[model samples]
Target: MRRAWWKEAAVYQIYPRSFCDSNGDGIGDLNGILQKLDYLQELGADVLWLNPVYDSPNVDNGYDIRNYRAILSEFGTMEDFDRLLSEVHRRGMRLVMDLVVNHTSDQHPWFISSRSGRNSPYRDYYIWKDPSPGGGPPNNWGGCFGGPAWSYDAGSGQYYLHLFTPEQPDLNWENPAVREEVYDMMDFWFQKGIDGFRMDVISMISKGGYADGPLRPDGLYGDYTGQCANGPRVHEFLKEMNRRVLSRYDCMTVGENSAVTPELACRYAGFDEGELNMVFHFELVDVDGGETRRWEREHSWKLTDIKRVLTRWQTILDGRAWNTLFWGNHDQPRPVSRFGDDSTEENRVRSAKMLALCLYLMQGTPYIYQGEELGMTNTRFTGIAEINDVQTRNAYWERTERLGVSHEDMMRVVNYISREHARTPMQWTDGANAGFTVGKPWIALNPNYPKINAQRQLGDPDSVYHFYRKLLSVRKKSDTLLYGHYQLLLPDSEEVYTYTRTLGGEQILVVCNFTGKEAAYSLPGGWAGAELLLSNYGNPCSGTALRPFEAFALRHSG
Candidate 1:
C-alpha cells in the first residue's frame, strides 16, 4: 500500500458548539477553540476536525450554510478563524473544516433566489420539480428526518427537494454551475490555509430518478435511501471534484457517505481512485439499529455481529481503499455506553481503554470524538422536552402522536439512541456548566460530569485519557500498526475479539474481551511468549482467563 501523511495521523473531532466557551457567552466559538489548542496538543492529536462553523440559522446545527465564505457571528469573526488556523499550524497540527455543500440553508442567497420564481436565474441552482398529478410532493420520498422530502413554495407553485428538513434544500449537482460554485467555495478555504474538508452526506448529492421509492412498511412516505444514497452519478461528480479542486492542493478529504457498502466504498475512496482519501461508513455504527429506523425499540446487537462488520471492512479495504475507525461521532451515542460497559465507573474506564485498543490497532485512521478519551458515557433525558436534537424530537412525536406509542416508551428509546447524548457540554471541570461556560449553557450538562471531568482524568496516570495517549504513541511508532495486513482470529467467538496485523517479519496481536465476564481465550500458537506491549490492567497475564473488559496488545518477532 502507498504511504501518506493522513494514513499515519489520528483525527480528533471537535463539536465546536460543545467543546468550550469564551467570553462567558454560553456558546462555543473560534476563540474558545483557540484557548483549547494546548489541550488537544497534549492529547497527541495530529489533525483537528471541527464541525460546521459557517453562518447558519442553526436549523441542523450549522449544516445548513447561509454563506460559504463568511463565519457565523456566534463563532466569532473570520479573523478569529484565521488566527486559530495559524496557531494550529504553528503547533504542527492540521485543521480540517466541515464542508456541507450537499445542501444550503433555505435562507441562503442561492436558495432565496431559486425560490423567487420558476424562471429565476438561480432556479436551477437547487432541485425543483412540479407537483405530482394530485398536487402533492414531486414524489413520495420521505425526508431523512421525517415527513415529505419535497416542500412546496406558494409563490413559485413548485416543490423543492430537501432530503433533510425543509429549512435545508438539496443542491442541484446536475448543473455544472452549481458544482463550480461549490468548488470555488472549497478553494476559498484552501487559500486561507485550511487543511481540508469533512464532506457531509456527500453520497446523497446525486440522485437516481424521481420515481417514488419503495413504500415504507410503517410510514406514509417512501424510503429515500433507495433513490438517493450512492446514486449513479456520485462517482462522476467526486472524480470531477478531485480533478478540478482537490488534486491541486496538498490536502486530505474524508466523506461521510451514508448507505455505503464495502464494494461501493472502494470506488469512492480507492487508493488510486483519485477521489477522497478515506470515507466514513455507517455499517459498524448501525449494528444495533432497527430494520428501518435506528430509533425503533427492541433492537439489540451482538458482539459477534460487531466483529463481523468491522472485520469485513478491514479485510476488504486492506489495499484497495483506506478505512476510518471510529466507535461513535457527533450524530451517534457514546461508545463506552453503547458498545462497552458504563454502568460502573471502573467498568467504564476499562472498557473505554479496551475499545481504543481494539479500534486503533487495526489498519485504519482512528477518529476520537470529543470527550471520548475521558470515557464520557451517554446522557439520559427525563422527558422529550429536554432533548434539543430535531431528529430525535421528530421521532418522538411521530411515534407517540401518529403511531399511538406511549410517551414513556418513546423516551426509553430516546435515552438509548438520541443524538443529544453526544451533544452535551464537554466536561472540562466539576464546576458550573462543566466549565464549558460561565453563563447559562445552551444545553444541559451530564450530571455525572462531576466524576468524569477532564480535570480529574488528566491527573490520573491510569485514566482513559492517558491510555489513549499511550495507544496513539504506540501506533505512531509502529509500521506494522499503520500499513500492515489485517486478519481476524476466532471470528465466531462471542466473548472475545482478536485480530492480528503483520508486515514483513513483525506481527502484533490484539485481544479484547467484549463482555463483563471472564472469557477463556488461549493465545494463538507460537504467540504465548510474545512481549506484552500494552494492557489496560497493570498486571501481566499469568492465566488463560481474561478479566472483564480486559484488552491488551502483544508483539511477536521472528
Candidate 2:
C-alpha cells in the first residue's frame, strides 16, 4: 500500500454565494472567503473546494460559466481572488476551484459567437443538428432539467444540443479545438498557482447516445444511463489534460461522476496512472431512494442495502484506487435530513456523528459540506416557487404534469434533496442572515441557524465542530484510522451497524444503534468489551445497554 496526499486530508466545500458576504452587496465575495481562511483551518480542513465563481447570469447559480478567464464582478476583482489565494496558502491550506467545463453559459463569448450563424468560426465549438424530415427534434433525448435536450435555434435553423438547462449549451468534446480551449483554461488556473480543480460532471462528457436515446414513452427518449455519459474518448481528453496541466503540480482533481462503477472509478483515480485523485459516487447519498432509471420510482431503502453499498465499494477499491467519500455536497440534501432524524435537535447531532463515523472510517477521502459541522438539518419550503434551483423547479413542474404525483408526494421526494439543500446561506452566528451578510442574502438562510451557527458550535467542546476536529486529528495521527483494514463485525444485525478497523497491532471496533430505540443484544461474533475510544451516545460498557442512537468506537487492549 502506498501513501496518498489526500488519504488523511479533510476537504471543505464552499458555495461562495452562501459562505460569507464581505461587501454588504447581499452576496458573498472573494474577500468573504479570505475572511474565513482561519475558520477553515479551525474546522480542520486542508482543501477549500470553492464552487464556480466565474462570470455567469446566475442561471444555475454559478455553475454556468460565461468566461473562465474573468472572475464574476459579483465575486469581486482578480486582485481580490489573488488576495484570497494568498490568504488560503498562508494558512497552509490548498484551494480547489470548481471546473465547470462540461458546459458553458449560453452568454459565453464562444457560445454567443457560435450561435451567431452556421458559418460562425466558433460554430464547431458546440453541437448543432438538423430536425427530422417529418418535424420535431432529431430524437427524444430529454434535457436533464426537463424538456428536449435539443432546443431549436431559428437563427441557424437547427437544434443546439444541451444536456441540461437551455441556458447552458454543452461543449462539443468531439471537436479537438474545444478540447484545446478547455486545456487552455486549465493552464490558466494552474498558472495562477491554484492547487487543482473539482471537475463538474466529467463522466457525462463522453455521452453514448445522441440527439435522442432509443425511443421511449411520454413522448420522451431514454434515461441518463450511458445515454450521454462516459463517452468513448472522455479519458483520452482527461489524460491529455492531466499530462499537459493537472499532472504537473501536486494538483488535486476530483470529478463529480454520478454513476461510475468501481473499475472505471479506480481507473479515474487509480494509483499507478489515474486521471484524478478521486471521484464522487452517489451510491450512499441516494440510499433512501431506489436505484432505478430516471422515470422509475423505488422509494424504500433497506439497512442491509446501505451496508452492502458501502462495503462493496470498500471491498473493490480498498487499496487499488482512492475514492472521494462524502455524505452530502452542494447538490444533495443535508445528511441529517436525508439519513438521520430531522425532527429533533438532539437527534440531529447524534445522527450526524454516526454518518460521519461511517464515511470518515472508510477507505477514502472525506468531503464535509459547509454547515455539516453544525449538524445542520433540512429546510422545508412550502411551495415549488420558493425554491431557486433551476433543476428542482423544473423537475417539480414536469413531474407533477407527467407523473401525476400529488403535491405532498412530490414535495416529499424533493423536499430537501436538491442542490438548494447545501446552497442555502451558511449559518455563522445567530444574527440576521445568520451572520453571513449584513444585508438580505442572495439565498434563504437555514432557519435553525439561530442555535446551530458556527459561532455557537466553536466554543462547545462536545459540539459537532469539536467532534470533527477530534476525528480529523485521529485520522491524521492514529495508525488505524489512516492505514487500517476494515472488517464488518455484524452484517446480519437489524438494529445496529458495526465494524472494526485494524492496522498493525492496533484494532478499534465501532458500533452504532442506527434506530431510535435502546438495544441490548449479545456481541454476535464475540468481539467484546474494549476501551471506548469515542461514542455519540455514551461510554463503552458491555453489561450496560446501548441507548437509541448510541454510537461508540472502542480500542482493543494490548
Candidate 3:
C-alpha cells in the first residue's frame, strides 16, 4: 500500500457546538476549541475533524450553509478561525473541515437569486420543477427528515428539491457555474492551510433528476434512496472535482457515501481515479436496521452480522480502495450505548475498551468522536423537549402521529438511538454542566458526566483515556497495525471477534470477547510466546477462560 500521512494518522472528530463553551453564551465556540488543543494533542490525535461551523441559520445544526467562506457567529469570527488553524499546525496536528456542498441554505444569496423568478440567471443553480399534474409535489419522494422532498415556492410558482429539510435546498451540480463556485469555495479553504475535508453526502450530488419512488405502507411518501443516493454521475463529478482543486494540494479527502457497494466504493475512492482517499460506508451501522430504517423500535443485531459486513469491506477494499473506521459521529448514537454494554458502570468501561481495541486494530484510519476516548455513554433523555436534532424530532412525530406507534415506544427508540444522544455537551469535568459551559448549555449534558468526565479519567492511568493514548502510541510505532494484511480468525465465532495483522515477518493478533459470558479461547500454537501489547483488564492472560468483555492485542516476536 502507498504511504501517506493520513494513513498513519489517528483522527478525532469534534462536534464544535457540544465540544466546549468559552464565552459562556450557552454555546461552544472556536475559542473553546482553541483551548482544548492541548487536550487533543495529549490524547495522541494527529488530525482533528471539526463538524460544520460555517455560517448558517441553525435550521439543521450548521449543515445548511449560508456562506462557505464565513464562520458562524455562534462559533466565533473569521479571525478566530485563522488563529485556531495556526494553533493546530503549531501543535503538529492537522484540521479537516466538514464540506457540505450537496445543499445550500435557502437564505444563501445564490439560492435567493435562483428562487427570485424564472428569468433570473441563477435560476439554474438550483433544481426547480413545475408542479405535478395533480398539483402536489413534483415527485413522490420524501425528505430524509420528513415531509415532501419538493417544496413549492409561491413567488416562482415552482417546486425546489430538498432531500433534507426544506430550508436546505439541493444544489444543481449539473450547472457548470455551480460546480465552479463550489470549487472556488474549496480553493479558498485550501489556500488558508486547511488539511483536508470530510465531504458530507457527496455521493448524492450528480443526480439525473427526480422520479417517483415505491409507496410505503403508510401511503404518505416513498423512499428516496433508490432514486437519489449514489447517483449516476457521482464518480464523474468527484473526478472533475479532484482534477480542478484537490490534486493541487497535498490533502486528505473522505466522502460520506450512503448506499454504496464495495465495487462502487472502489470506483469512487480508487487512488488512480483521482476521486477521494476513502469513503465512510453505512453498512456496519445499518446492520441492526429494520425494514424501513435504523430508528425502528423493534430491532436485533448479531455480533456475527457486524463481523460479516466489516470483514467484507476490509477484504474487498484492501488494495483497491481505502476504508474509514468509525463507530460514533455527530449523526449517530454513542458507540458504547449502541454496540457495547452501557447498562452498568463496570460493563460500560470494559466494553468501551473492548470495542475500541476491536476497531482501532483493524486496517483503516480510526476516527474517534469527542468524549469517546473517555467512554462517554448515551444520554438519558425522556422526552422530545430535550432533543435538538431535526431528524430525531421529525422521526418521533412521524412514527407516533402518522404510523400509529405509541408515544412510549417511540421514546424508547429515541432514547436508544437518537442523533441527539451524541450531541449532548461534552463531559469535560465534574462541575456544573459537566464543565462544558458555565451558563446553561444549548443541549443538556449527559447525566453520567460525574463518572465519565475527562478530568477524572485524565488522572487515572488505567482509565479509558490512557488506554486510548496507549493504542495510538502503539499504532504509531508498529507498521503492521498501520499497513499490514488483515485476516479474520475464527470467522464464525458466536461470542468472540478475533483478527490478525501481518506485515514483513511480524504479526499481531487482536482478540475481543463481545459478550458478557465466560467464553473459552485457545490461542494458536504459533502465538505461544507472543508478548501482550495492551489489554482492557489490566492484567496478563494466564488461562483459556476469556472473561466478559476481555480484549487484548498480542504481538509475535521474530
Q: How do the predictions measure up, each by TM-score?
A: 0.98, 0.95, 0.98
Per-residue accuracy of model 1 over 327-435 as CA lDDT, tens digit each: 9899999999988989999899999999999999999999999999999999889898898888888888887888888988888888888888999999999988899
lDDT of each: 0.90, 0.80, 0.89
After superposition, the stretches of candidate 1 with alpha carbons farther than 4 Å from their true spots are 211-221, 290-292
Order of candidates by lDDT, top first?
1, 3, 2
- Prediction 2 TM-score vs. true: 0.95
Looking at model 3, report the run of 10 residues with the lowest lDDT sum.
212-221
lDDT of 3 at 329: 91
lDDT of 2 by residue, 463-517 (tens): 8888888777767776687778888866877677888778888887777777777
TM-score leaderboard ranking: 1, 3, 2
- What is the C-alpha lDDT profile of model 3 across 109-151, one tens digit per residue? 9999999899999999999988888887777778888888889
Candidate 2 residue pairs in clash (backbone atoms < 3 Å): 206-231, 207-228, 207-229
Query: Cα miss at 346, model 1 (Å)?
Result: 0.6
| Predicted candidate 2, C-alpha RMSD | 2.2
Error of 2 at 411 (Å): 2.6
Q: Any idea how many clashes model 2 has?
A: 3
Off by over 4 Å in 2: 211-215, 218-222, 290-298, 522-529
The better-scoring model by lDDT among 1 and 3 is 1
Shift of residue 494 alpha carbon in model 1, Å: 0.7
